[model samples]
Target: MIESMTPEQESNKPKRQFNNLVNNPVMEDYSLRYAPQSFRKWSEYAVATSALGGIAYLADFAIGASIFVTYGFASGVWAVILAAVVIFLTGIPIAYYSAKYNIDMDLLTRGAGFGYLGSTITSIIYASFTFIFFALEGSIMAQGINVYFGLPLPWAYLICSLLIIPLVVFGMTLLSKLQVWTQPIWLVLLVAPFLAILFKDPGAYGAWTHFTGNAKGGASVNFLSIGLGAGVALSLIAQIGEQVDYLRFMPEKTEKNSGKWWTAVISAGPGWVILGALKQLGGGFLAFYIFGALGATLAVEPIQQLIKGFGVLIPAPFIALTIATVFVFLSQVKINVTNAYSGSLSWSNFFSRMLHWHPGRVVWLFLNVGISLLLMEFGVFGFLNTVLGFYSNVAIAWIGAVVADLVINKPLLKLSPSYIEFKRAHLYTINPVGFGSMFIASVLSIIAFFGVLGSTAQAFSPFLAIVLAFVLSPIIAILTKGKYYVARPDALGHSAEEGDTHALNCVTCTDDYETPDMTYCPYHEGDICSLCCTLEKNCHDMCKKPGVIEVSMRK
Candidate 1:
């Protein structure tokens, strides 16, 4: 018969010594485990505002301008609206699940159907989103620097890249304060250009409605144009991952705080797209307003757009340029901090699972920023449309698969487990349901995007990814009977309830964690934390093997 290990045996095993960066809760921020209730002490408003602050990025402006320049007013505007609707709808379930479970997108993905190792691929995809957009945002900042300070693009790129590192190193403890404090100033600058246009140049709006840059159909709403435009806009679907990075820190909900909790989740969660869509439209209008003066190539640049807007309000050219540069700098810092922060989390998840060792989240922060710096040096902004358009296909498919598992499989079909099981000991290495569906959908969509299925199919390729992933996830779950989700039952046999804040001390790490992060390790014959379970190389998953003796938690 199986029996619990004695304390003497547990103490005889070696204890892991994490570096100071990983050991400090303020800096570590539970990058690889559940956000226990004790750590989620921030108010709902504070968390929501910090999450919302990440949307200060100017990529929406660039995307809007790019689409409108390529496809015309009617199709571009409609595409922005369409993409926002889809993003908002899909974001709802993901945000709710992440907030309720107190897990980041990576942890949630592991349980949502991708399983333990299956999420590694999605981690790369998500990390790609961070760096790709980081480079894009950093490029915009470089452009402002080049225009105003007369700095070379290379130097500007270095400055922009290095500036975010200090801000992000401390994780949420510092980030929450930074984001909340700067939000007001960022908001004012965000709307300054539009407000200037409304009062100083009202006729620009009329001209914007009629402007058509390179579109063959002029201002007409062509179906192909709408499809292609929406594809680029939808590349941002993975942004929900960054939002939930903060949402995971949400305080536990209760009858008293229920209203504030839901409000924070919805507003800071999917509600981000509402502002994002507006920014896109605003970007399109600004691009149109300045096209005559700056021509096509330079008009889409946010710095140029803001300069022109500020020029209208402030008659002095020098003052206008100074303010515009300041605004651009502020915006980039706000969003790039988030990009670097989220990228570190994603890279941590990827490397820890792959190598069975984690240096720390802070180590990966430099890696993420360094990759973005390289891209900025090479001028990724020049190929903006091509880059984002192609990326949307794969991103939407991954998000679609995760959403299907969250919304359809768990509740309606009752195929997946009701509560998330992210701990490695209780989950299989891979589950075919989400991983398979996403893979198939991404491959087919990429093929279509490359015009293998002809022009119309190519234009609508992202839609193909979304439909196929959503439809296939439930079907695959039913076919597999959901056996791949959990490798073994919880050894403690405790209820997988969200509100259970009871803490347990891991014998290996010698640290106290909430019950959800603890699991029985048959190899060590003791309870282990999720981070320790992930880093254990010797166990070889002995606890999960069939006919292996069950190890119970010590009383």
Candidate 2:
């Protein structure tokens, strides 16, 4: 015996409605749903270029300089390399799954192990990463404006924050074109100063290699210094989320295009860390070269670093300053647009699950930028190391849990699903596998970070987070027998099957979505889109009740 919704019962249910912003594909960019095959029209190269464009951020320069200033050359260099390796390896599985599944990181997290509502906290963590980096990048831009244009920091922060809104409002429609067009000039400008330094001041390299700042042992590698430096650098582990935001638009892979597809995915996915590491090393060198002239406070600033690097090539100081300022402006705009765009998506996912309402992604964009602007006004740049070091603990735990589920639990242990299942109808509200592991790891790591566990533990707290989360995910999954992974089996046919482009009409929204984004709704007596399924409040998950069968749509 099973319950069914009668026609009269269905008629009385609330109809789904969305505002104009969510309805417009250009404005929406499928912020809360899977990107369909039709909308994924860009070539692999185009998507990869657009994704890589965000790497133009100058924060790497400041981060690298800060690490070197805090630790000696040996420790700082090793930390950057070590962090890059870890970021690259962890990023591979996440990037592959997101691109292959054509869903953003938030959606992937829901299916990977975090469950539906279990991923809400991760959304907040991801959103925090976006705004924190947005503020950091904004601060760098403001510093350039203060030096070159004589504008106050406050006015410059406001201008920088507002300028990115129009660009991000359109989402990928405009960002792809913008990235392709500006990439050439940005690359040329990026390499010019480094090349000039190599030729004009070759001796600076030797000087930089021997330079020691506030490290305990001058010019020698300290394990503690390396661990601390790596912790600050690992804060960028969440950067993969921003990359996946663009990678979700990657076109479907086929036998004819498999090579190009993999190349694009790998290059734009985890390959971001390769270039990131180089930029950080360059930043360290520039800071070292300019350290004597600029002192500690100014040496770590990207604008000052570049101004000195360009001075090696340009005889005129005004011309060098102008070029450095232009580069800073260009870099900030490119990265901030990504930060704002990704933040909006994260916030939308978070609030939709919590409040069951989505005003639109555009509304969240303003909120993200507004928070970043406040951080800049407070001069967050001064505490760069402190801010990033603390953030890495929670971020690493989140990423570690997701990666373990993707690589270990799914593939090795077979405790998770073979494919991603993100629909609200099929998922439980919470899955203790990833959520619990992240929670336990984050708490212990935070305690260690605050010196509760001793100095050694404090410096390597992020490492503790990753290791604990990674190991605990499978243990939890096995203990729970993987029952909580999905609340109900997907009654809908395999939407991920090869060449299955069949579109299903969502009864609630009266819109056509691909099979992947459609799920059978017992309450509606028809297929419902994921967004509508997520927003339905009256059903109370009747589909998941024992012996409650969903109406078949086989006819």
lDDT of candidates 1 onward, in order: 0.92, 0.92
Error of 1 at 435 (Å): 0.2
lDDT of 2 by residue, 136-234 (tens): 999999999999989999999999999999999999999999999999999999999988988987787888899897677999998988889999999
Q: Provide the lDDT at 325 for model 2.
A: 95
The local lDDT score (0 to 100) that residue 278 gets in candidate 1 is 97
In angstroms, how far off is 95's CA in candidate 1?
Answer: 0.3
Each candidate: how many clashes? Answer: 0, 0
Clashing pairs in 2: none
Give me the displacement of residue 98 in model 1, in angstroms: 0.6
In model 2, the worst 10-residue window by lDDT is 546-555
Model 2 error, position 487 (Å): 1.0
lDDT of 1 by residue, 148-251 (tens): 98999999999999999999989999989988999998888878878888988888788888878889998878999999999999999999999999999999
